[model samples]
Target: MLDRRRLLGLAAALTLGACATGPSIHADYDRSVDFSSFHTFSLASDTPQPGAPPLTWQRVSDAINRTLQARGFTRSDTPDFAVGFTLGKRDRIETWNYGPYYAGWGQWGGGPWGPSQTQVRTITEGTLTIDVFDAKTRRPVWSGTATQRLSGPVSQAEIDAAVTSVLAKFPPGSTQ
Candidate 1:
């Protein structure tokens, strides 16, 4: 039997679950370093994943460039920091089942009454990771990651938005 408290708890859980969203963002950096000292940046000469379309690289570079430039950072041959990024995807399977089945008591004692339904779904999750390294130290100074469910082809707007969100905390500590 479902009591009043149990019913209320179930309703709250369902409501919260329904409101859940994907495409989370996270960032971290070395606290000991002074971000303001870094003024210029240049893209690293790392090769894109084999077989990746050239357009994808172009889009990412353009998006990062736009964000950094907007933040008053200049791109130069000899920069204080270097920027690089990686993209990846993975498969995930999710399944859900309908409510419990109720047995109906008739002349035949007890039998299955309510229909039971179940469903399984496959989802592809995409991740974008950006790394910033100090050119002199050749070590990572800052990094950010964004994860989200992927559907169909990725759009330029989506890429731009994700990059912007990840870089929103750029330069860490000090407000700039």
Candidate 2:
């Protein structure tokens, strides 16, 4: 016996909960490569995208540096592995259908099924891909990708969270 307003509010809340669970992270590394030998890293020179904001790139780089340093990897001019990352964003459309809500039996059809509701919204999704390559051989050793729904302009806090979530699996085996 819920009103239309309350039912719609509940549906919106459920949708938000599903969307706000943070970034989806995935990581992979070469099995033959001994990640333990990688003790130092240097940031690769990356050309910013033609129309992208500079601060977003910088924020990601800073977050990578902080995360790696905390994991006991040092920055060096001549390094074991080189780190690089790319950022991308795209618009996504999400649709949710909330089926009938009961409001007590009254009409000839016994409550009229409350009328099915469909909600649609457009969201921006951002993705960050971080790659680690062996400086000597120039072969990739480890890579992580994080994807999340973004809210307008990207913020440093969001960048940090995404970077941290992605790199938490770096080196493959050890707890980070």
Please report the candidate that would top lDDT against the real structure. 2
Instruction: Tell me the deviation in Å of residue 156 in model 1.
Output: 1.7
TM-score of candidate 1 to 2 decimals: 0.76
Cα misplacement distance, residue 102 of candidate 2 (Å): 8.7
**For every candidate, C-alpha RMSD to the true structure in Å:** 13.5, 10.5
Candidate 2 is scored at a TM of 0.75
lDDT of 1 by residue, 39-123 (tens): 9999985465443445666777789999999989999999999999877666689998773343343425454556676789987
Shift in Å, residue 138, candidate 2: 1.0
Error of 1 at 125 (Å): 0.9
* lDDT for each residue of candidate 2 in 8-78, tens digit (9 for 90 to 100): 33322222122356888899888999888899999986554444445556667888999999989999999
Candidate 1: pairs in clash: none
Off-target runs (Cα >4 Å) in candidate 2 are 1-19, 96-116
lDDT of 2 at 48: 49
